[model samples]
Target: MNNDHDSSLPEGLDLRALSAFVDGELPPVERAAIEAQLAQQPQAAARVAAWRAQKTALQVLCGASLRNERQAHNESSGGVGQRDVDEPAFIVVRRPTPWWQRVGLAACWLAAGAGLALALGPLAPRLTGGAWNGLGGQPPSFAERADIAYAVYTPERRHPVEVAASEEEHLINWLSKRLNRPLSVPSLQEYGYSLVGGRLLPGEAGPAAQFMYENTSGARLTLYITGISRDETAFRLFRDGNRRTFYWINDRMGYALSGPIAEGKLRAIAIEVCSALGGKPESWQ
Candidate 1:
């Protein structure tokens, strides 16, 4: 696989190679080659950055569990004792587990305890309570996820979405079935943003959909949709770094419009989207 020169290029680097590079599993020579290619490919570099960010997030979420496990292992086996160098003591150096391996274990632990913390909504305050108050009082998790999805996909020069706008009907139908809800693709052309495409995603409850749109200036926006148990919310704005999302729940469904544009412009676009989808646009005021 390392001998394939074509695979080293941005266009040819497959997901497996990219995963290996993110995991730091590549040899120095192959790693250097991929790095050179990534430097020339902003989209590919963005993907790598996203993966790294995901790993970091997982580590933080599962840090306490990991520490407990490490402590347990240390107790099960006799703890290592310090030795003085002047005594000429023989010290056994045990290599630590790789971060990826530890993170994998933490992921399993998290999966086993998933039900404790579900999607953020009205019930979220009761479930997570003061734990998430620092994030501006139970900020919707789906909207934050939408912001992340937009950041991850909008930088692509090619293959930004799983399906293209040319296959709009098929894309909508497929996503609708997967999400178990009739979905509509809002026409953003009037706002100078045309539909680019969309893809299915894993949501806090079940499947979610993300429809992407791009304007003439190459600026992109995405509308993320998912099912919710209840319908009670006013338009709310969530800011994550440079990205902002205007989101709300209506008719037992949640929608988040995410972009890097100015707050006023994105809110206008989001209000239009809400109105098109039979939502109460007046609530946005």
Candidate 2:
């Protein structure tokens, strides 16, 4: 009865279920079900790869920051042999907490302060730029990042991506492992472009993914992705040097396409990718 490895998984494993599989929280039956989905749904596998990359990136960023701070302290204090009165009690500052957070207090007090804090949070942070300025943490610059990545990978001849599209199953499984997002590499054959290949890219968010397709004349386009990030708040067209970028983001993930194609043709390409992606343009804005 099983047609593919993915067919042996639960049923059609949606993004959420795939995420659970990556996180090691899925039970065996459920895990098997997701494996089933992966066998048939390439896009779902790609999403899983993007999500896995995000998890690794998050840990790396956090771990590096911690390690750097400790190293700095050791260097300044002569390997912790000396201490100064002016030195703060803690060697390194932890991630900031916004002013409205009253977690240390009683649960009763937390309820009352939560609403007022969130309401007034932005204004106070902007005004002071102290706790709020560096507080609540900062997100990586997704827009500029997306652009840079688009510019870097679209021009390769020999090694543009890690897993080439010819091995569609391998590409899906590898990316799914790397991204932690269940991905489906939307078929672009109807757009006159067949799959050329896909690559894993490093990004501020994590290992970003790019899938390349080529047309008859060797013209190529790419689909860039990561687990959902806030920068995908709007649908916009971006131009970098001579290349064109058409990008959009949805609830579960984000996508950007870059290439040296005509705008009219590129728009059609983007529309097809978006439709295959199963995203709503309205939510992006």
- lDDT of every model, 2 decimals: 0.83, 0.70
* Tens-place lDDT digits, model 2, residues 1-285: 533435433455544567679988989998887778787877777778888898777656546445557768888988963444443334344888765565555566777787767777668766666545221323234434666765676577787777777798898888878988777888888878888878787755688777888889877777888765553345667666777777766774667777778887887777777877777654533
Candidate 2 TM-score versus the reference: 0.47
Which tens-of-lDDT digit does each residue in 20-138 have in candidate 1? 99988999999999999999898889889999998877666646335556667777789853333344423346899999999999998897666444444347557665454433465
**Using TM-score as the measure, which candidate wins?**
1
Find the 10 residues in a row with the least total lDDT in model 2.
133-142
Judged by whole-model lDDT over C-alpha atoms, candidate 2 comes out at 0.70
Cα error, residue 173 of model 1, in Å, equals 0.8
Task: Give residue 242's lDDT in candidate 2 (0 to 100).
Answer: 71
Clashes of 1: 0
For candidate 1, the per-residue lDDT at 128 reads 69
User: Positional deviation of 243 in candidate 2, in angstroms?
Assistant: 1.4
